[model samples]
Target: MRRAAIVGTGAIAAAHAESLRALGDRVELVAVADVDGERAAAFAKEWGVPRAHPGLAELLRAERLDLVHVCTPPRHHVPIALDCLAADVHVLVEKPPALSLSEVDLLVEAERASAGRVATVFQHRFGPAAIRLRRMAAEGVLGRSLVAKCDTLWYRGDAYFEVPWRGTWDSEGGGPTMGHGIHQFDLLLSILGPWSEIRALAARQARAVQTEDVSMALVTFADGTVASVVNSLLSPRETSELRFDFERATVEVEHLYGYTDAHWAITPAPGHDDVAASWREKPSGVVSGHRWQLAAVLDALDSGEPPPVTLADTRITMEFIAALYASAFTGTVVKAGDIGPDDPFYKSMEGAGAPWADAR
Candidate 1:
């Protein structure tokens, strides 16, 4: 059995522990580590993990682990992942993998030299409905994807930002665009292909944070499709939604956080009633969550293949995020491949800092 350890024991770490428990036979949960030693020990006891460490360095020195889950804060992701790669241990890092494109490139280079691979946690793409949608779209069952809408409108009050790192550009990476809505838009990118250009704007309307609480973008895909995206922390009726308007039908999923088949629906255009059958043919009952994704990661290790949400796949989404910020901050249209090593945005999501930095 493959041996695994989690590097953080926080709220999200519980999901990782539960998933590893679910895949109990295939993988062994050997140990855990956290900055708070007492919390780590408690988590280990609760999860039945064998050992606990005060930090990743201590855990690495004590264990011969096959995989490490980097569930730490945004700023720590790259450093912890670098340590894992140096030890040739595979990593399943949580979302917003790195704070900036520069940090992502650092992991990409480290991965190239390591015997193990890295995968980002983007569980939405693994759900049965999303899987079926991708298959249908690829088979031309959906016809040309004309337009799309991705919205992550979730409410987060001022108290939510009290968590020292919750609202900062350096620690949380960004506001809703980086922290919340990325899951929805990443699923959108998996359905549609590469995005070409983006024009966007961001504002700190509600939350008193260093980052923008609301942002909007108009995106143009490489295949000539256009989309509208919005990430906000001010909506009372919270929901995560993605809608794709293909020539044959419009496919959508609306859920607050995680989703099952019940959350998805399709409405076919006139003379395309057959589309419904294609959507229904796929087996259901799979919920999008860490468990589904962790299982896939283990399967890949068994087959000697890279896991889902590979670095290459994640960079596409990361580039889109950086471009969105670049567009919003500069008041100009930012395109794919527009930000390279020399561009300020390639090093920091805030680039030269947000336009409203002075106010903050």
Candidate 2:
């Protein structure tokens, strides 16, 4: 069995543990680590792990680990990933991969520097519903894709922001865009391909966070497709969904319970009367993305191949995120292919914890 170490004993760590445990004969959970040593120990005990460490380096240097699942908050991503890659250990980091494109580039350099792997955890792609959606779209079920509407409306109270880094830009990155809705945004882009431009508006409409709790953007894709993505942390009941409309067909899926499946619905528009027929097709999948994502990672490791979510794909998302910040700040449409290394916001994480009302 391939040995693995899970860094970060946060709430989300349980899901990762549960998923990894399910892969019984394939992977062995070697250790659990968190900044709070007690929390790490408790998590290890709860999951029946053999060891626990107070920090990532301690775990890495001590354990004979082949992989590290990074479940830490956004700010620690780059640092932890650098440490892991430097040690030549594979990594699967949680979403909203890093703070900046520059940070992502650094990780990419490390991955190249090592004989190991580094993949951002974008588990949504593994969801059966998502898998079918991508399959059908690529098979031409969606004739000429035109528009996509991706929405993430979930609520988080003050208690949710109790963590010091929860609502800050410097640590958690942007609010909903980078935090809660990042997976959904990444899924949408993964299905629709890359964007060419984005016009955006963001604000702290509902929460007292350092970034926009709600935001919307108009995006134009490289394939001449137009899309709109909206993210918010204000809904009473958490709902995450995506809709894609095409000239011949349309595909959509909704999850009432976060990225993991509570349910899914994918419709293939009919030949003549499309929308009507679409309503007739049934949806499938009722499992969380956690399991499939973990499985894919193990399989890739065994096969000596890269994980599905590539760093370049992640960089694409970050590049677009930079565009959103620019457009939101300057009140102008930001072109995607236009952002370059020379841009002022390129490495502008200095004072990053400031108001997210404007990043430009």
Candidate 3:
């Protein structure tokens, strides 16, 4: 069995635990760790895990880990992942890999050096809606994609900021873009392809947090496909959706918990009844497939297949984030893929003092 250890025990960390337990006989939950000793012990007791480590180092020593899942906040991903890589353990980390694009580069380098795998949790990419939508797009049911959009209009109250790092530019990265909006947007880019350039406006409206709780962006892809993205944490009824409009059809992808079945409604464009008829004749589509994503990684471990999500894919997201920061900070559009090894963020933004304390 592929033995695994989880090194964080917070809310999302609990989700990791659930996914691991869901892995069942194919994987074993070897241990859990948290900086807070009591929390670690409590999690271990609750999950029936045989061991609990008060710190990450202790967990690594106790468990012969085949893979390690770094579920700590964004700030903790780099250190924990580096430790695992050095010990020759495969790693699966939560999204936005690190506080900044540069930090993720280090993990990428480690993955290369060890020739092992490290996956970012683009869990939304596994949601029911995402899987079906991707297949439809690939099969041209959407018929030459014309437009894509992502929205995360959600509400967060005063109690939401009760946590120390929620609103800050530091611990949690940008308020919604990195924290909440990254999910659907990642799915958008995954389906639509890398963007050519971005023009963005971010504001700290409707919340007493350091980062923008609401933001909007206009993106232009290399193929001239255009997209609009709006992300917020202050909406009354929160909804996350991504839609793709193609020359011949439009497909809407929707999901909840960022998991579960995502419905896809494919409608033919004004004069394309034939395309819709073909879909009706061949409607043997797939279901919302989060479990399938997990199965991919587990099967990779079993058969030595490379994980589907890779560092290059994550770099595209990071490059966009860096450009987003540049746009937000400079009040101008930023080109993707323009930042390179010589950029200020390349070597160490921390030492240079990043615009955001977290630099993401």
In terms of TM-score, the best-performing candidate is: 1
Each model's total of backbone clashes: 0, 0, 4
Worst 10 residues of 3 by lDDT: 348-357
Model 2, span 1-360: residue lDDT tens? 999989988988888899888998999898988999889888999999999998987898788889898998889988998898889888888877798777888888888888777788888878766776676668775577888888888888878888888877688767787777788888888888878899988878767667777878999998888888888888787888888888765666677544433355444455546543543456454474777888988888889889757788888888878778777766788887666667655664222233444543
lDDT of candidate 3 at residue 221, scale 0 to 100: 89
Candidate 1 residue-wise lDDT, 256-327, digit = tens: 889999999999999999998788785578789999999999889999999888999999999999999999
Off by over 4 Å in 2: 258-262, 266-286, 348-360
The total of clashing pairs for model 2 equals 0
- What's the TM-score of every candidate structure? 0.99, 0.91, 0.90
Colliding residue pairs in candidate 3: 128-288, 129-262, 154-233, 154-235
Candidate 1 RMSD to the correct structure? 0.8
Best by lDDT: 1
lDDT of 3 at 157: 91
Judging by lDDT, tell me the better candidate of 2 and 3.
Answer: 2
Worst 10-residue lDDT window, candidate 1 = 277-286
